[model samples]
Target: MPFKNDERELTSAIQAIQRDPTLRLYAVAKTYSVDHRKLARRLHGMQPRRDIIANSRKLSNLEESVLVQHILNLAAKGFPPRMSIVEDMANRLLATRDALRVGLRWALNFRAKCEDPEVIRSWFELVQNTIAKYGINNADIYNFDETGFMMGVISTAIVVTSLDGRAKAKTVSQTPNNPIKAMSQSTFIKTRIPRHQNSSPTSIYAAVNQFTKGASQIMHQLALLKAENQNLRQANEVLSKRRRAKKTRLRQGGSLSQQDAQDLQDERDVVQQVEQEIRASGGRKPREETRARRCGKCGGTKHNARTCQIEIDTSEEEGSE
Candidate 1:
């Protein structure tokens, strides 16, 4: 008679016969509804047909399992690889066989086929029947938009580690009082320092940590001060430019409007405030070479047009010529 059951049933029958010495192969086969001859053949070290077909594929069972684990890892990290990446992985695995090529749709088809439609249908049916039996309303049901993961079922975790195996990284513990116990759990350390009320290895480590933290805070404050100084310098330069414009207008015999005079007064107040701030911060105000007095007509420093020295010198030279 033809085999009445699948490979799984045949395997179970063989296992039953092996477990109980008294149980005959024919009886076990009959109980499982598998062919007695096929069960006997499998019991006698015959490999399953599926295993033979799997051996002919590009990736072995072990390699496939590892790749699936890698995918799950990336998914857990919220950066699951796309189908194209999976296709590339397949191509790399089949690199030894130049003639064999993996198609672009291979990964998608494999993923779709992995999900059992019967299992999914059963799950939905179970949920619907429960809701119907309990008389639950739609308002009571809630759906979370985020991905859900089962707690404690996943044993793997992602961690950062150096590539070198010999390099050891020290872990700082939040529990300073129990540093010894915590450090002992993670690493083996030989402590030469004797235990005392005030002085211990843990106390030294804690003190160093506190000092490092304080230094970091001080550095941060210094950075803020430097930035504030830069901002003040920029504001002062702007005010200086405005003052130059005002002086130029006044020198050209242009009367300042009320608004212009108010603006000039506001600029003076701001400059005084900036100077006070610089003095309070123990910083010297940077010299502004742009604000140096220069004659408008000759563009000469140290003398204005009213001083009339450069013009007099040029006139005497022209007269002599």
Candidate 2:
């Protein structure tokens, strides 16, 4: 319905929203899109600062990583990347196009590195502008992008044929993963976590995704990995079954068949042969001897302290006389 009057229309919508007891303030985005700032301006411009609600819960280590991601995303989207707190929300509450550009600029360039105080303040203005343009208080307004960082470029080369002047047959320069970038914090891109799977896919065709878009590149690589994983899984399953079977046999006092016994003997022989081969390759063989008490005087292993040969020899001449 064409708004009967701008003020009347806004007031009606606002009233309806207020009247809906079950409707939540943060639960909707369209509600914040009405440019209430303009409406208030016409109505005496009595801009009042109202407290906005921000939700938070205790975060574990993993949850903290998620929250860091969350903050980074908000920072990317031109939102005030404030800690979980309630405060007066302005620019984002009344979003505008110009403001959104500023926010994006800030995310991409300003926040990427440390800057002079004045530069940071100006960049903050950019962020505010982005928030004003977008008017997205809730988290749904932002988009995510995953950028791959590959390391090696000079290691290989490919030819590119061109049809136009200065663009014809040529080689391209490549940047490694650790390539240098400007030091300023503002000149950064809105980077999101490289997700293993889509957090929110737009369609039923799950396999037909951006990740699977390049059939020759991504799909082929993933296909090889998938095949390898399946092979390993199959091998693991076989090994597990064998181990369980062995345990069952041991529990039941199972006896080996003639062929199985022969196989065990063959395995034993192979191990023994290996050991013998190693020994023959100049290794010392260990001796097996009975343990016996030795006499301290004679350094012998068999005789005890009494009646030792050394003790008898000491009285040999006296005995002869």
Pick by TM-score: which candidate is best?
1
Give lDDT tens digits, candidate 2, residues 1-321.
121334455555456655884664333224544454444443454422332222222222322222333344434554423311101111221121122212322222211134589976886687577668967453432331111112242212311111121222135322111214221111221122234266554332333432233222332233334544676799999988865775577579996667755655786789887786677667555222333456787777766677677767868968998
Q: At residue 244, what lDDT does model 1 achieve?
A: 91
Question: For every model in order, what is the number of clashing pairs?
Answer: 0, 18
Clashes of 2: 18
Model 1 scores worst on lDDT over the 10 consecutive residues at 144-153
Question: Residue by residue across 1-321, what tens digits does model 1's lDDT show?
Answer: 555758778777777877887998788887888888888788889988766755345654434543554555556665555666565555554553353766655664543122579977886787688778988666445441111222332223322121221233256534323446445433422232344446556755665565444444334334434544676799999988978989899899988989988998897889988886786578554445436877988888877898958788999999999
Best model per lDDT:
1
> Model 2 Cα displacement at 200 (Å)?
35
lDDT of every predicted structure (CA atoms): 0.60, 0.41
Candidate 2 lDDT at 236 equals 100
Q: Every model's Cα RMSD, please?
A: 23.4, 26.7
The stretch of ten residues in a row with the least summed lDDT in candidate 2 is 84-93
Angstrom error at residue 214, model 2: 7.0
